[model samples]
Target: MANQAAPVRSFLQAAAKTEEAPLPLRVVQIEGLAILKIIKHCKECSPDPVTGQLLGLDVGSVLEVTNCFPFPTRDEDEELEAEGANYQLEMMRCLREVNVDNNTVGWYQSTFLWSYQTEDLIETFMNYQENIRRCVCIIYDPSKSNQGVLALKALKLSDSFMELYRNNNFTGEKLREKNFTWVDIFEEIPIKVSNSPLISCVMTQLETDSPVNQCDYDRLQLSSTPYLERNLEFLVGCMDALSKEQQELQFHYRILARQQAQQQAWLQKRRAENMARKAAGEEPLPEEDPSNPIFKQNPEPSRLNSFLITNQIANHCNQINGAVGQNFSRLYLTKALHEN
Candidate 1:
């Protein structure tokens, strides 16, 4: 199963120095430095999504991400995919020699408009699971951050969902049996940015100079029209994708229905022929024919794509709701100030 992250095997094996963390990872404690690095890398890339390997230790329930570095992006897609593994391995070796936290905890990537729910992401997670017992993908959405919020999150596939996904069965019956839903696909672990005492003191000292930083204006800005419009666009796209998946499912059902109808018609005709032969004192042909194409079972189409599309749609809706809520709050505050 060489996937999008197939090249990470060498790097992960080399970085496997710590004890494997137990299941059901609870929290992700990312260092302040790592957060800055992720933001910087993602912001520098801007519209282009970039990926990087996360380095740190996973202790019990808390996965601490201490450092990270961006993956090299080449214009030729194949060249990058082929060389990406080697780049990570070399980076790990260099960091290990320098006595840095070279242990591979997980990986991080930037997303567009917080739309990180996709099969490609799941494939990468499965790839990481091969080497690491537990891992999280730190998702940073630069597009969402423009609204004055730190759009970083720690996400991992839910245990149950992963189990079902491993079997590659996203059939509706199987999903209903397992109580799996689109929302259950990814488990978002709470992220806590950890800074050292010295760094904390430095930050406190730096904050003393300003009662309110100039950056606060970004949040206070009432111009949310663009954000709302963009979110609606993404939502509409997801809706169209979801419709296409539904059409596929419908087509599968139509074919299945037609097959079942043909099988019934064949059986009726066979029964009538047997009755006529019996009246004529002649031998009757067998009613059941294994060779009949109508008897072949029609497998239901995979529901994974539809489920993922639904999840993506939910993400867009949540963002839209959040933006609307913020707008309402600001409007109320402004009204109160004007009244006073």
Candidate 2:
């Protein structure tokens, strides 16, 4: 039979490195004034070896107070008086349980009323912060308590003040409006010394059995019509291709017209030289035999030769053409060419 391993040191020693079991939550109800309770828990044994307990917690520490309020003195004595007394008792009960530093000062009315001067509170909390798996602070605020009389002041604790400092570090105060909401109540007021620890503990609690809806910062990008990759590139390419085609077509048409005009002028010069030679009694040359060299090469006048005459034909022959109907065919030559 194999020897059993030596009994591990006490359970506490074994559990030291292991996570501390969750503590059973217990709440203390309070009435009257609002109580800020901040508690720091010390490591301790659980009632059952399997279970763990919470210790030394600072829920919230600032208490609020207001001036004398009107109570019914004549007709509505019993109900209002009972309600006021019950409210006061609950507020005090909450305050008494609040675990402030042994030397923590207590403010009264509106000034620095009393002093406790506690240093051990932080020491105890730092110890727990290092070892304890869970740390917490409990606070009780009635729905109606002098309209939140014991609201946390900015000077309550170093952690609370530091939190405020961090929050205000980069914020623009001038643009901020008066926002009164639950987040404002929790964040602005020094409810818990530093919200970081409380936040961590809350996250741990949620990990156990709750579904957490995580919040994330997401980025979205948008662009105008010109910047789209496919659409923009295609449009630019199409426009470039169309412009290039138009320029090529224009050049082709112009070159063809110029060549046609040059050919017509060369033909006219040949006819003029042949006509001059023929007028001196030389035989007229055939239209295509350029080497028969002695005859005039002038052929019958072309329709195009009367271009200028046609232009004047409308003005000169309009009356005659109108009277003769289809029989007004007559050739008109240029006046200067006829005289020559």
Candidate 3:
């Protein structure tokens, strides 16, 4: 009940007053900044079930930046220690703020599988399994063609959230009586992932060939192509160091074909505008007015001009090399790809 709306609003207000936005080159503070790191990279990253443009969501497309943390894994031990028990207390406090009673909170573990304790915050943590079991909705993008992907899996952990919190290794009985186990702190919010109702709901949506369903089926049908087999390790490393300009350049390269199509559209629009006036019995506009020769009869942009425009349009549009250039070079890249 600690982070009730009034208190949290006050805290956010106070926090906002002191927090300064980071400049282009400054370290960000945790109290203000939020980060979401996605671990997506797989072969089935495509939007279509069979064949479509190969523009699947890469392992790099970060989804949302919620105030909540990712379900903690052992890798985050150091962070947990640094943040202290207040972290667990805060999570419970937030739940309580929503009017979840103590009785309902106890049932949360059976539904979700994590421990919760308002007092012993350090060792008492919510089990991610319990949270997963209670998740009401799941979402993923469908635009990416299959260059890469991330697979979501059901929680298989045996312990509850509070059990694994491992602050000082107190006994299970003590934890249960103290309301440190998953059930003690908050009610099971009437949502359960593993509950029967959710299974049918998941099954209905999963019957289709959507990315989520494909991911599930692929796990059972095909042998996984590990990330090690791909250039992803190098890609991830490269991505970490990419400048904004470089990132934009990469995006431009990815959509070069579409960009070409868009230019043709613009030319068509101009021509149509000229013809429309002629049809209306008005003086047809010249391609370029003699008074403004620059606007008169402008030559169609060449590939080179498009490249320069792309760079001008986006900061990260620095010259690209390798496959990116193969798709976007001024010269014949499609022919080159076919030859290869």
Which candidate achieves the best TM-score against the true structure?
A: 1
Model 3 per-residue lDDT tens digits across residues 1-340: 5875554557778756744431121111111111112222112332321111010111121111122222332344476555544555665567558753211111111100011112322222233234322111112222211212322211211233334334433333454455443322222212112224565577678676554655544333222233222333433433453344356555655566565565666667768997988898888664433454233342221222222223222312221222244334423644566789
RMSD of 1: 7.5
Model 1, residue 17: C-alpha shift (Å): 18
Clashes of each: 0, 32, 36
RMSD of each: 7.5, 44.4, 26.0
The candidates, ranked best first by TM-score, are 1, 3, 2
Task: lDDT winner between 1 and 3, please give it.
Answer: 1
lDDT of 2 by residue, 231-273 (tens): 2343354456445645655665576566556556656776777
Residue 40, candidate 3: alpha-carbon lDDT: 27
Alpha-carbon lDDT, every model: 0.90, 0.32, 0.32
Question: Model 2 lDDT vs. the true structure?
Answer: 0.32
Q: What is the TM-score of each candidate against the true structure?
A: 0.89, 0.18, 0.19
